[model samples]
Target: MPVGEWDAVLVGGGVMSATLAVLLAEVRPDWRIAVLERLDDAGQESSAGWNNAGTGHAGLCEFNYTPQRPDGTVDPAGAVRVAEQFAASLVFWGRLVERGVLGPPEAFVRSVPHVGLGQGTDGVAYLRARFEALRGHPLFADLEFSDDPGVLASWLPLVLAGRTDGEPVAATRAAQGTDVDYGVLTRRLLAALRERGGEVRLRTEVTSLRRRDGRWELAVRDRASGGRRRLRARWVFVGAGGGTLPLLQSARVPEVRRYGGFPISGRFLRTERPELVAAHRAKAYGSAAPGAPPISVPHLDLRVVDGRESLLFGPFAAFSPRFLTRGRRSDLARSVRLGNLPVLLASARDNRSLIAHLVRQVTAPPSTRMAALRRFVPTARDEDWTLVAAGQRVQVLKETGGRGTLVGFGTEVVTSAGGSLAGLLGASPGASTAVAAMLDVLAACFPAQADEWRPRLAGLVPPPTPEEVARARRVLGLAPVRPAVAP
Candidate 1:
């Protein structure tokens, strides 16, 4: 058996690992890095253009980030933080483009208006308040709101067409929002890594992980030949999406005991009709469904992949025992252990509404599903749109207060004691915030080098300083979002 050694072994070829590889290459070029993917190709799961909505999640349109306060005020802190992270990502991508590491921006990311929509008095009021709260923030400077039906028709003709106006509806638009092909971006990043002398192995799985002689050892199996090999790395990263938790557990990591994952599959209604696709060039995000979690928020988006335009809507949920889109059926039940059982059971008990929503979605009749699309596109035809499978997202369940609880909708970084190992958990705003997330991993996993790495990191990504943020907005051609003024 051949034994390979490296400075790092990144499990998974999705955006997270690819992004980390890019950053590491620029920061520590001499250190060898290898990315091992179980799938035959990179980004086959979560990061695929077809699998994700591809919104450049800068908090411009997502309502989940801003919550209403007691005084009826919308707190924009969460949104601001998310926006900041996205800004860093923009900076990273922009620099990569300039360096010829990535191809044309239009290939992977394109400017697409992002809008938040709501109807009824309660919903309208929330949208109105949210707009007011975010109006002058640096990150939301160019945000605009309109309650006029005539104006809405111009912005979202499909949504307003063939519908009579009764209850007032409102929307907020940010023309600087984007639709990104994370899969393409992932491939480009991997290309950049290879250009810099890094390695990526597809159709290769990391079968097991163990600590041996103060180093991490991974058992690798080639799907083609069924040949097994061993490899060692000074540091290891589990960015395998839903596959991360189980792999961490297999390594006997103590931190993995507190974490479990539940698979959530999404299906989208996609239309390639030129007319429909042309009518909507923006990503319109609506409020979460009744009794639904933030992750279940419905969105209607215009996606451009490989230069082809299309519209996608409705992330209808379904039940899948597999952790990944291609994982084994026994994945869900096999993940259970005494340490994580309480958390898993408690999460199941607490997330009854979520489970119920999934059940309703799976059992929904054709008419029922059509009605959903009608909410976003009043004149949507059953023939114009076809149901298509999106990606599988696994939400992380963590033990909190001795009970398992679903983590919030954003991403979380988990590092083992001594920082020898690290993994990313949770869903939503993931790929869009990969650079910022990887920065956190770098800081947590390599504290000794963080200070020295900070200056170099700034060159690779958007900085946190106000001046740098302003510069990033300019570099990325973003809507003016300077920072909100006190209302």
Candidate 2:
């Protein structure tokens, strides 16, 4: 077989590409690999710690993962699957630590409690059900739930402070939940991959992709020098966050030809106030406004970026034309094409409430956001928090049955059936599930080498044997649950 120009070329320096690059480095160390990033550096866009909530997203506190049914029954399948997938990521990170590929674990992940909290009759019922649904799962063995004010006060004093009303309130906690700085983690993984001799090209943008003799020829340009070049690779991956859709479209990949993006910009009320920040420790998640997207569910998160702890609340969703934080303002318009016109128009007609929620979020004054924050921190002072722009998330829209469908609230890996190209789209449960997501890409694209690669992957994210799962839990600082011995 003729050796291709390069073994693999990965676009985007964010979590997805970094993750796949690291995995491929371990699986195919001898293959030539390159990671090209459009930004001046990696981790500046959606991967930035401040740009996201930084929640580990293990379904520990994100109630949206477990939805209630029409008959008042709650489904735990989504929550359980998410927890299992996130555990795979923990296992991968733990192996990296044991192998000394990464520095101190705290540099990227920090243990913070994950709490699901609610008030009133409906809120209390939901929390109780959500807590019960997850209690039996080994992954959530350390979970706890309560309705007592004293119990809640200890777990979350800020939310309960100065509230004397006998209004019913309920909460659940998983002590081992984490806050992960994807920005830091992304840079760390890339560094390790670099140390292993993988090449990383920064400030280089891929303008187009063309297929030539079963390989991909990427048209690249150096943003600073205004120089253009072409790079050839056996395989190409578009993991450029919101930019993935356009690049996939440019590639003319039939798999992603009709896909479009609906850009959602998130803003948070952030506070570094010692008093306010110190009062909250857990990431508190609450229900979303009726008809709002699940990703917009309210949450007050404890974020640790660059070792400084702060609080972030209320992702007041708004509309934006740009797919990325630094992308051109005309990005949304550029994405509109004949292929996705009907689907785009259909989504508009079907999701009126979602569109309305976004509009209300944008028009709502600062005071309205402050009011939303007050739901989590009853005594939160407006003076204590500052409204700050977070990041851009472009949710994927696809045409199915000749109508547009909102695919999901999490990431989707789009790949060619033949396995030469792959792109990731959607948002939520994003970086926290990078390991599992990349594993999917590998399984899809590397079918030829999969039999050989499986054992290597198993070494890292081993089968969930009793001992194996416990080991991964221990690495995350979670207490290992011992199987009960017959008395």
Instruction: Determine which window of 10 residues in candidate 1 has minimal summed lDDT.
Output: 478-487
TM-score of 1: 0.96
* RMSD in Å for model 1: 2.3
Q: What lDDT, from 0 to 1, does candidate 2 have?
A: 0.85
lDDT of 2 at 56: 82
Candidate 1 lDDT over 1-487, as tens digits, reads 1349899899999999999998888889899899999998898899999988999998889999999899888999889989888878888887787787887667788789999998789888999999988886777876888888888999898888887758778888888788999999999899899999999999999988999998899999999899999999999999999898888889888987868888988899999999998889799999988888887788999998878999999888888988899998998998888988878888888879888988898899878878988888888889988999888888889877766578758788888858989999888778899998998999899999987887778788856565665565455555445332333
**After aligning candidate 1 to the native by TM-score, how far in Å is the CA of 321 from where it should be?**
0.8
Cα deviation of 252, candidate 2, in Å: 0.7
What is the per-residue lDDT of model 2 for residues 109-219, given as tens digits with 9 covering 90 to 100? 877888998788999998888877778788877788888888899999899997767678889888878899999899989998998889888999998988888889999
Q: In model 2, which runs have C-alpha deviations exceeding 4 angstroms?
A: 1-4, 464-466, 473-487
Error of 2 at 447 (Å): 2.1
